[model samples]
Target: MNAKTETPAIPEGACITAKVPERGTALLGDVVVNPYKLAPLTAIIRDGGQAISAAHVRVLGRGERGVDIAYEVSERSLWTYGGIPVFGLYPDHVNQVEVTYKLDGERIRERYQVYAPAVRLPVVANQTAALPLVEPIKVAPGFEHRLYLFNHLLGEIPGGRAFKWNALGGAAEWDQVGNNWIADSNGDVRWYLDIEQIHDSGRRDGLGGTMGFQQTRDGKLIWGQGQTYSKYDLLGRRVWQRALPDKFADFSHEIRETPNGTYLLRVGTSDYRRPDNKRVRSIRDHIIEVNEAGDVLDFWDLNQILDPYRGELLETLGKAAIQLPEGVQKQESTAANELLEGDLPFGDTPGVGTGRNWAHVNAIDYDASDDSIIISARHQGVVKIGRNKEVKWILASPQGWPERLKAKVLTPVNAKGEALAEEGGLYAEGFDWSWTQHTAWLTGKGTLSVFDNGWGRNFSPTKLAGNYSRAVEYRIDEAKGTVEQLWEYGKERGDEWYSPVTSVVEYRADRDTQFIYSASVGFLTPEKLTTTVLNEVKYGTQDVQVELKVSSRQPGSVGYRALVIDLARAFS
Candidate 1:
């Protein structure tokens, strides 16, 4: 029997249709599904006769694990949606997706083949090039750390490998932590512990790419990759895995542990249909607090938090063919669906993965002192949200902003405490607002340390001439709503190097000198790929303490983020 004939037919008025990719399978049966841009397959369902309330969608990958999907009916009548997200499929492999729903006490089923494409590395002419002049300075003797790095898109790079780099010797070490580590692709958890001694079929081909990794003082290996947030002990044992709610997946970036034993997960939420007939698609950043039992305790919706300023945002940042959630539609401006992407409120563009890059919120850190959350929205700017759901302060350029919107931004100043010329009282003099920034955290000195990716600097009205990356420290005064750039470390080598995406700067205070760990440095283009690097610099002197340029086996490859941690503490 043919594949279609083998599948059972549904009753009248009940049909399932593909909503996302516009169709099932590739055009002309080419099987061309971009692995990196795998979209969730949403099947719109309309059941007749007795109203269908819930459905169980079971996904069995041809050569992968099984995923159980739960679909519930909303306020809408007789129609419910079921989806098997991209994360549930094995790349380069076909999956058997089965959907079962009941009507009039009878069970109905539907099945289809989900073809996932293989990883196709970007074409690069030069795989290896001569070393650039990376002048490295001396470190404060006896100070060393282990730099943990994960290749941004592992299989997409020719020879990209996620491993630890010994800061003292400046060499990549893969076996330091363990030859085996665990990773979650879709919902399948792969455990590769002791490759030589023991074997597991589900072991990933290589260590999967991670946006962030942390080893707590107690020795729990916490990591957030793809859409899953997981924790493991030093022995490579799984502790807990978060079963994130549907419609919200892809924890593509940062996750941190709060002081209260809760996990702060930076997740991507998309495809929120509003009531106004606008099929809204957005990769909105979300910070959800997950407790020890993998229960979401608290959540701060960034899109909703910033929705009130939609009018000013459109006017200031320029308009685009954008759609906001229903919550943000309370007040309206000359709102239309015709605007350039560069002029979008958050510098987002219609591109890979979701087709709408609303706000690339990469990193989020919790501040216990004030009970606020600091988020690095790469496409927009840095934001500090208070416990009371108020935007406490914002750090971004106010070039084309209206007077009312400008008042919401904190005025920037130079290192010498000199206010830059104020264009509507929101302009800065010495330095512009950080563009395409990342990895911001509250410092012990009551300042914000950020990895300023510097992607937006060149386009600023008051542009900082060279393309470069800087480890910046900013002092944000919430009461006065003012910001002071306390110190910044870049511009020594001009535009010799800059990371337009995925980088970090962590403050380290010791006896004699103050240092910052800067890692995941790379160059970014509008094409959305980077060439990575790592840097360690001293605080006051702005001297390069220790640096590791790209000596990757994969010449044109990059990593997402990096960190400097104690080698003993990390592997222990």
Candidate 2:
């Protein structure tokens, strides 16, 4: 269809803009645009079914010539929401946009007034009023940092707020909350704004989503919406987006920026069918080097590299492999599957899928110190790959496997950092060692920090009593082939804090604090939804400094990743 020939003439009052008036000012602190949460202005154009060929926004500043801002607009597809699309606005600035759209044999111009208002948040002066849902706990006092949270999926709350996708084949009741919050030293939220909504593909699979909804040093948001990795500017406009190759399939759970202007993305390709018509869910993980502009620079597939060690992995799967439940096979083709997983945050359906989520890579962290990368595989174990792509070591609980198979795994060290020669590979059982974990990174002290979701914490064969989650730090001595547990939080909280799915652990040296954010803290229950909690604690002593917990206020709510940083530093 030739757009120019099919387009019709413009109608009177054809160009208009709609504003979802601000409910109230959220205390956004300053006038600086926080790129991670800026809302872009929207406009509509009606041209008698003539498509808008091209459109641009001209921002008119005081005493200055208009600055043209490039905008990406398309016809609205949803029937209920009908509007010609316009976006890419400057936040918190009152200005006039001279919008021009190329139509049938002519250019139509329209001027619209728009404003991005600033929000003034309240100071947390009282604990009782800070959070009214839970009991009044003594919060820390006089805090100055802000917390950014990216929940993989937010189940519909009691209120009318609803997310767009429902992977469970139920209602589209889940949403992604990319929110920013300010907390006092006592851990009470003084100000907050639900800046953006995102979708996390791995939320429902018991494997979490991207380890980051992180803002780059230059204030650009870098995140994964399923198979595609995208970047958005401060004005909430998607500036760049890149998808994995068809062979690479979809993003698993992590993406990180390199010292150079590039990214390390963890993604996977499924090998569910063979030439012989056999069916098996064999997910092969890979790490692709991506440039700042969202181009793939390089890639390394772990499956090919670790194929020799397949027997070892099979042994590690042991009881888990046998006990795994069968799921439904999707009726769609791979091409159709790709379309479904594209910009949206849904790839493999949680339970109803053909492939086994084997080697579910959930987190990737680059160790610049050693020129290596540490990856967390929820179904297997954490593996460190050197610059040459050599598997330096594999760290796991090594319990379910046969004693002889433990030789293939790494050894562990005691309190004194002394290697237990006989106890190599097998760490203390029952929620002590790493298992079904997410988010692994190097601490300032050169130890590995992990968010252990405590999956299979109470395996039937192992019969471990408790099922709980915790933020744990381990000192790994590659030279000695040993891993030592340095410290942990939530070990005493029991299942009350057992977040089996999404979570994060951040250790801040400047503030001597450890922040633990959980997406679903409550027991995975059907009667009620789960709650997410953000806890700030004294780093070394594990003293409770502050705690901010929020839920959808609806049954079965869940969230994803969380982190805290200085707001001023983040923006400036």
Best by TM-score: 2
Off by over 4 Å in 2: 1-138, 142-144, 155-211, 270-284, 307-355, 399-408, 420-431, 458-465
How good is model 2 by TM-score?
Answer: 0.61
Which tens-of-lDDT digit does each residue in 297-383 have in candidate 2? 787766444321222233232243421222522222333332332232223322112233446677888888888888887766777
For model 1, what is the C-alpha lDDT against the true structure? 0.48
Which residue pairs come into collision in candidate 1? 87-186, 227-251, 420-429, 499-522, 521-533
User: What is the Å distance of residue 465 in model 2 from its true position?
Assistant: 8.3
All candidates: TM-score = 0.58, 0.61
- Distance (Å) between predicted and true CA of 92, model 1? 30
Clash count for candidate 2 is 20
Q: Which residue segments of model 1 deviate by more than 4 Å?
A: 1-140, 144-151, 155-209, 275-281, 307-355, 399-405, 413-418, 423-429, 458-465, 510-532, 567-572
Look at candidate 1 and tell me the lDDT of residue 525: 34
Question: Candidate 1 — worst ten consecutive residues by lDDT sum?
Answer: 168-177
